[model samples]
Target: MEMSELTALLTREGLALLDETGSVESSADVARSVSRLRAAGHSPDLVSAVVGQARLRVKARPKFGEFADRMLFTRAGLEQATRLSVATMHAIRLRRAGITHVADLGCGIGGDSLAFAGAGLAVDAVDADEVTSAIAAYNLAPFPDASVRQGTAETSLPDEGAVWLDPARRTAGHSETTRTSAADWSPSLDWCFEVAQAHPAGIKLGPGLDRDLIPDDVEAQWVSADGSVVELVLWSGELARAGIRRSALVMQAGETHEITAAADADDEPVRPLGAYLHEPDGAVIRARLIGEVARMLEAGMVDEQIAYLTGDAALTSPFVQSFRVRETMPAHVKTINQALRAHGIGRLEIKKRGMDIDPAAFRKKLSLKGSAAATLILTRTTSGRVAILADRV
Candidate 1:
């Protein structure tokens, strides 16, 4: 939003009108609201700001929950913002470490700052973008201890308190942005590393970040929400847990589970296929702690080069999705399709690892005519490629 529009939206009249209009779900609602507000003789800037924010609030619900109703957002800021649940975990870590104040550097719309403030910690939130800083200030207004400022993270770093850095990994834009190399990130990764080394800090990064870039002194944690790997966070100094170099945090079904190790765990020896095949959560696979999970399930690697684990025991855990083996067949489409047809299977779920074929394209080539359903796992062993038919456990 422009400065003029933000100024207008901060007014009593604009806020009242926005609250009255409520959440906008579609372009039709936007048009109707615009027409009504225009007819009421509201300024075009105020109308645009209110309508735009109403739409954003709807999109923000999944991340912010009910708090989104009274909050403000910009498109890109909302997109990059951390989810409330995940941010709360970060806040908990700091609080547990005896940190009383947090400097949320590169705080986009104050997502993490909200969590920090809500946890009863003083928050100094900073963002480089002017409009986003203003929006963050508004969102954080309810917390007396939270403050938002517009400035580069380098200049705004607080002399006291733990720091939370989520450097801008994209080029600046309100609606659309282009990804940047780590070297080009605002408050460059090198600078972030130096600051982290000096203070109790947490650096939030993309889940796909290169392991080689991770500092040795920090604890690297991979977090997954539901089934998706969401982020990699590096905790430094007092925030870093002792003897824990790698950690996987899984948040699913309102429960959180963590597996940590001093370093990447060794891969289990590959063996023949077992009765059950387990697919580890992405966070587990990313943290390279599959060996730890393999021991828990009494499972062995389906292939040394792949992440799939297999065992005969009927076991399941939140760290992995288990599938009961039905049959094994040659990896050829004709052989699999005939087997599938013989089983009277019409619905199929395709899973793959260590294979080049596209599951979607492969599914199209099959003649699915029966009523039964099965999952097809396409993978390779030391011998050759094979297909495993299975059912979800």
Candidate 2:
């Protein structure tokens, strides 16, 4: 069927067809509909609604398949591909700073743009892809001053109070290639830096990006959500008044750990690893300030070479999590099987740190049965297969 006929069908049928037909085929149908609608000179709002409904219907099932179609049919649809929890925290931080006018460069599917607009800030949202731009326009339709434009951030935006840029880290094919140069992404740092010079700006980068790659003038922030490193936030203008670096841990319920970036300050002395080994939070690990974390916990490194930090006193630092050291097992497949059998460890929680062990094969090898749950951590500290029962702190 042609794109227009499919779009007309969607406009008449709503999204129930998507759920009935399954996302794979539904997405193709949706794409065809979008093309038809565009050809028929449909209003952007109607196009946006049809596309948004299609996306909302298919997003939960087989995400990538539907996502590709959405990106193809709707201008700003790929923005929904990656939803950064840390970005929400950054927007909150900016809102608290009393910044009113916000421009979101590369505003994917309007996640951050909608967030800022919801927070009562005027938003100028831009994206390079036509489909994404349309999706963004629809996504931000409720906001009064939210404007979605189809253009690169360098060209679309005018001077504004604050700017948010999420550089495209994943390439065209969605491969995990390291971005060594700025030109690789749509809005290059050369453009972002110029925007930063004009007004307060926030740039989002990969969590694993090298610390040295961060510009000295921008406040580079490593953010983690629920102990996982999600993204890096670089701030310019008054946001960087404290320093050029920072770290944050954002919990699911909007709780946050905000820390300044001062690497040269005197670090608290390290103590010996005690009975408990605390795993540092993702933000702290990504920020590479484990020494400071040890200071906060009054913990000493068990093995200076290892990432594990041990401490006698149980202190709270958003950096590392506290885990009770339960039992130590020998690093052999048979030995592990024997231990699991001995302890009646029917259900196993396999966690790996510095070691390389296939979780699936290990679970299958044990062939566990019964109603018992114990957390097994496979890490290469001094030894391997360190099994410990962990409870969240």
Q: Which candidate number maximizes TM-score? A: 1
Q: How many backbone clashes does every candidate have? A: 0, 18
Q: State how far residue 172 of model 1 sits from its true place (Å).
A: 0.5
Q: In model 2, where is the ten-residue run with the lowest total lDDT?
A: 67-76
Give the per-residue lDDT digits (tens) of candidate 1, residues 134-164. Answer: 9999999999999999999999878988999
The lowest-lDDT stretch of 10 consecutive residues in candidate 1 is 379-388
Clashes of 2: 18
lDDT by residue for model 2 (1-393), tens: 123433443444434433333443365777877676668686655555555455554553332333233322332243334353544566677888889888888886776776687678889988776555665675577778899988887676665588788766545321133445556766666777777778888887777776776777777777766556667877888666474365555464457666555552233344443567777677766666777777777777655455777766767665666776556666666777776677677777777766667888777777576677676666655443354444334
TM-score of each: 0.97, 0.75
